[model samples]
Target: MSISSMFSNKTSRRGFIKFCSYIASALALPASLVPKIAAALERKPRLPVIWYSFQSCSGCTESLSRAHAPTLEDLIFNYLSLDFHDVLQAASGEAAEQACEQSMREHHGRYVLVVEGSIPLGAKGAYSVCNGLSSLEQLSKAAKGAAAIVAIGSCASFGGLARAAPDPTGARSVAELMQDGQIMKKPLVNLPGCPPLPVVISATLAHFIVFGKLPELDGENRPLAFYGNTIHARCSRLSFFLHGQFAESFDDEGARKGWCLFKLGCKGPSTHNACASCKWNGGVSFPIDSGHPCIGCSEPGFWDSKGFYQPIRGNVPLHS
Candidate 1:
């Protein structure tokens, strides 16, 4: 299909520049570099992204699909040549698998491989199989030819909740497998969360397209631009946190009054992400905004090891 088929007529150099201006200003970048950002956005080719599924609920796909102002149509059609995504593609069964194989072959050493779920490494890896091929085998083979691999959710990035508790299928993360140096040799970027913010995905794609490389990453390989500051750094309720006023229960007056949820097991103080600032569902709301505690889903071992509903002592000092 053509680019025009996916994006609105307004998707032009000026519109892209206006977008960069908004994003740069949001990230506190200098206005003088707006033209540079625009030029970078204009020149880069829309990357080919091959999205894979394993043992997952497809929440990451769902989250990213909600990108607004420029919806997934814009994302897949304008910014990315999403050659094969199991969830969004029209084909099914053999037809779908073959299409993915063909795209991988056609874009060999050129496409971005986005793994959305964890690989089940138990019972001969039989837990999740597609087209009679084990997910592990398919992933390993796909990784071998990808230019770069992005683990797009907590599942693929850190094994997520599926790997929690007994970990019945021995779920493992993309980084764990890649770290052993036996699979794909491409650089990896992890965007961990139950569902990462859409802008985080957009920014990563933009960085690759503009800079021709991944953004500066944290020790865990997450983009520093999005994950550098704690959620507490940008949370709207931080003022309440500083005053030591916290909600003691989900439906109590404190909560009703929009007091901080730190006392009710919010992990925002230690969680690093742009959830508060970028929000979700088209910048409408986030976990905290919706009256839910920040579960720290982006951090490692968040599912199984996250502490109980109580304020953590000796917590980092609240921002003024």
Candidate 2:
């Protein structure tokens, strides 16, 4: 019941090559390497993934499972072979442990470890445990043999709400753990958000598949393509932001009229993510578009900030 057990389908070399070709086209890869990429895809084999949760809400999972283009079914069926996710897997108790062990042993040197939520190290990892094992122990064991590690959600990437002042749980990010202890030699990619936009997740995965490696990352290990620009750069209400026409309240005329949310503690300018462009619920609406301020959930330490309702910097004057 190793990590390989999570993979439900087998992709033949020929079929994988064909899929690679499609990815090449999708990412606009040059024609000369299309065949090469196709060949690599066919022979490289599907990466096995192990998703682990910790001391936090499963919003990241919920968001990812409900991704716009590739729903949970498509992700499970097509993208990666998710072997042992406690939340999604039906197996429990010793059965679940056996399944995870089986996949780990089978996949061995190659697998993607996706972690959500922060680990509590203060209480000797007692804050969160699964089947009598501490979250930190599980993460360390799994990360040791993974090909690449993805820290999903702000909780996992930057220790979200759990790391606030007077931190009783001792919540910490995967990066801190990795830096403190040598867990794996593989690369680590951080996708920070209260719950990253579904498209952002899909796009990151797609980039990995297309490029055969982690996407170009920022100083924070965030994908440059997705986190390169601030949300304010592409905000639909930029004009309003510039003019200081902000929504005073949730039901104010400004809000109803689609004005900016900057005055309402909008963190668009300070945060970076593809939310405005990638959107949510199949491009229907994002927080700002839906009349809420940008909470900067994608950035680290957003929850512990001074206030969620205070405008950033608190000095910009209102325009006419």
Candidate 3:
């Protein structure tokens, strides 16, 4: 089916305009660009996407699929052409591999590569394999012709849980793997979160689609618009933290009064992400808003960071 036709049956003109507006807003783009973004989507060819998995629990995929506002189906069917996603595609075995291969060949050096898990290099990458090939092999091959690559989660961006102490699997982030072998010279973007906010994923893709380039990236290759500020800076509890009004415990009176969670181990002060603003579950609430601490899941080596519930004071090592 043609790229534009795929949405013709499911999306009305108003819906498409709304989707474009949402994308623009999510990316923090100016309202003036909404019409341009809409026009681009209407005329652009489907951007083939190859999604690969390795050492992950599929949390990232779940986050995207569970998005309720505009719905994942709407994004996948209309905005991008998901050529191959092992967990989502009906095809399996040789059929699935063929689909990926065909997309790579047809769109050579022009398709987007989205990786969802850490790549294991230990034991010759025997720790993770698809079909008969190791994770390393799959990534190297797929990345060879990719136009751009996006490592879509903490696992894929950093070693994440798989690279914690002991490191049995010798898991490495996509960028590390790329550097090790000097493969995949294509531009790369990292979206690091335990399970990145669904809208962030959509907005990044939208930015690429509309601007024909990746958004400005921070030192970690994360989109600057989303990861630009410390969560504490934009947090609703910032005043509480500054005023020394902190919740000592989960059930303390201070906690009940909606005070800061800093004393209770909130990582907001050190974590850089849009959680305080973008939020989760369709802008409803984020971890901190729900009375939990920010776990710093978006930062590298977060799993090995002191402790999730341990306050970041003398013990926790600051990123900067």
lDDT of 2: 0.78
* TM-score, every prediction: 0.91, 0.85, 0.94
lDDT of 3 by residue, 1-320 (tens): 34357456677677778878887777778999999997887778767899998999999999989765358887677667898999999999999899999999999988889999999889988999888999988989999998899999999999889999989999999889777764566799999999998987888887887788899999999998889888888899888877879999899999999999988878887888999988988789999899999999999999998889888876432222
Q: Name the weakest run of 10 consecutive residues (lDDT summed) in model 3.
A: 311-320
Candidates' C-alpha lDDT = 0.82, 0.78, 0.86
Q: Report clash pairs, candidate 3.
A: none
Q: CA lDDT of 25 in candidate 2?
A: 42
Q: Which model scores highest in TM-score?
A: 3
Model 1 agreement with the true structure over 132-186: per-residue lDDT tens digits: 8888888999998888999998999999978998999989999998777646668
lDDT winner among the candidates? 3
Looking at model 1, residue 65 earns an lDDT score of 83
* Candidate with the larger TM-score of 1 and 2: 1
What ranking of all candidate models by TM-score puts the best one first?
A: 3, 1, 2
- Candidate that beats the other on lDDT, 1 or 3, i.e. the better one: 3
Please provide, for model 2 over 1-320, each residue's C-alpha lDDT reduced to its tens digit, 9 standing for 90 to 100: 22233233554445545545544543345567777754443344555889999987999989898875546665566666788998999989889889899989999877778899999998788989887879888988998878788899999999988987877899999999888873554688999988987766665675665466787789999987678888988899999978868788888898899998887888888889888877788778888888888888888788877788888884443320
* Cα RMSD (angstroms) for every candidate in the order listed: 2.4, 5.1, 2.4
